[model samples]
Target: METVKEFAGMAAGTLFFILLTWALTSSYLEEYDLTSAKPATASVAAKVGTKSLLRPPAFFVKIRQDDGSPSEELHRISRSQMEKLSIGDPVSGYATGPTGFSTIRTIVYDSIFYMIGIFIFGFISLCCLFATILSIPAIDQAEQRSSHKRAVKKKRERRKKKKKPKRTRSGWGLALGCVAFFLLVTLPFLSNLVHSALPAGKNSAEALIINEDSYVTYRKHEDSSYRFNIVFDDEDGETILAIKDVTPNTYRNYSIGDSLPIEYQTSNPYNIHVRGTTLTDIQQMLLTWEMFLYAALFAVSGFVIWAYVNSRKNGRRDSRKGDRFASR
Candidate 1:
């Protein structure tokens, strides 16, 4: 009766996992199809205007008709597309909708991130399914052992052994060590992987250097350290403010009211990058491949360690059984 209950619980858990995986997969497929659709080319003549001042700021285009009259409808745009436009610059791209209300799809709005979600859920579901299947044999073996009185006595004897406690502690220690190692090695790569997937600064624009300052920190028996910072704002009257750390030479080179060439991330205007600092397409591809390689190595190393530890434990158990039989 207990075994039946255990099986039922496992079935329920496996079904839940499978359902979650299916939902995520379906959503991902739908998004993939939307993004894969061929975009239409259309001439867009509109004046750019800010729609919202929120984070990940939104913009809209006041469409101008061919007869020089403004259309009633406004088309929304992303930050990357908006950055290149002044209050009234012509916007043109592969449009995603009808002529007067077309939107240009940019990297910020892509569905690539859904791939990561689907992959994670699918992996979890597969692991749950395999675990449930493997546990059936273990449950049967446990039931058979429980039916024998001598097996119960032997189990009690094994539990009382001091070596069993030490072995368990060692196993737990190894597991913790492996987990720590895996996180230490993979966390940086994972961070880079996610960052690479997101939209970065693509267009360069000059920001007015509003202020510059230097601070000094003195240490005992050491020369005072100087930190230079500059504050800048973009030209769109959008009030994009960013403070950047600069070297002594760079700080001295630019003064207040100077135009500083800079690039800011589309998703976050405050996260500024120096001009020409963004990764190229090939470099981004290499970074993704490197992350995958590190993940594969960690998985292989963990499997090898687990297999070695299990073999050692099995050998010890077999030697103990042989000693008991010889004595009898």
Candidate 2:
């Protein structure tokens, strides 16, 4: 019984740490657009025609759109642009969108991510570390308790039956179990609520699919999903091509050479979301929440098992009592 408790605590702690980390990091990235641009050095290494593993330099530029909406796109500059540019210099480029050219824009290099990365990653790491420290003593106490309970149980079986203390609901174990059960049962609804509450992207664009790619996921067996290589023009008639994953249903619904609607937040264009799909920051949070919620359910399962063992012990005592009455 104690073994079960120890396993439950450790399992819950591990899952909580993992899920919390993912939720925090993902939210942080989406909120700040940390990965929209790459190092200027990476852009230099990238080739124009090939899919270079090197990242693009991060830059923020106000796109000269025909509508004059004062919108800006965050992205990395090309190799040639980086060579000609210096700090504080305005680099010119064409702003691209889904179907047609948006406008010409001037971009500048920015490298202030070191501090942001330190703060976000540091906070997540500390949370995991503290959780680990707390689990050690919990495991030990559970093990000791299990040993004593088993010993007492064996002694009771050999001796004559006595009236046991009435079971009560005031114990911490029962309370914790109830809380865990509540969380487990309501988890799906909570996730759905959070997803619905997340704000939709204000900016919309139409992207033309150039090609498609597929990958397998372990959800409900080997589920397949698709991604698209899309091409769209900016404000200056320059084409921007990128790959983005679509939902499984959406992937199957569309084919190569098809055009689909995409939307993104005003703060970060690269944080794109396909229309009518569940893919968003909230969805990522829900996935992480799911892992922790399942762990919570398992933690409570330990209590269920412990209760079953105690009930069996009580049943044995009652059987002995019936036998004595019958003999008399």
Among all candidates shown, the one with the greatest TM-score: 1
> For model 1, how does the per-residue alpha-carbon lDDT over 238-299 read when each residue is reduced to its tens digit?
65534454433445567888877766555455545445333452343333444356767678
lDDT of 1 at 315: 78
Candidates in order have lDDT scores of 0.56, 0.51
Backbone clashes in model 1, listed as residue pairs:
none
Tell me each candidate's TM-score. 0.31, 0.30
- Which prediction has the highest lDDT against the true structure? 1
- TM-score of predicted structure 2: 0.30
Kindly list the per-residue Cα lDDT of model 2 for residues 160-279, writing each as its tens digit.
Answer: 354233333345457656767677665654543443346753466787888888877667533344677666653444444556655556777788889878654344344345666545
Model 1 residue runs over 4 Å out of place are: 27-32, 39-123, 138-328
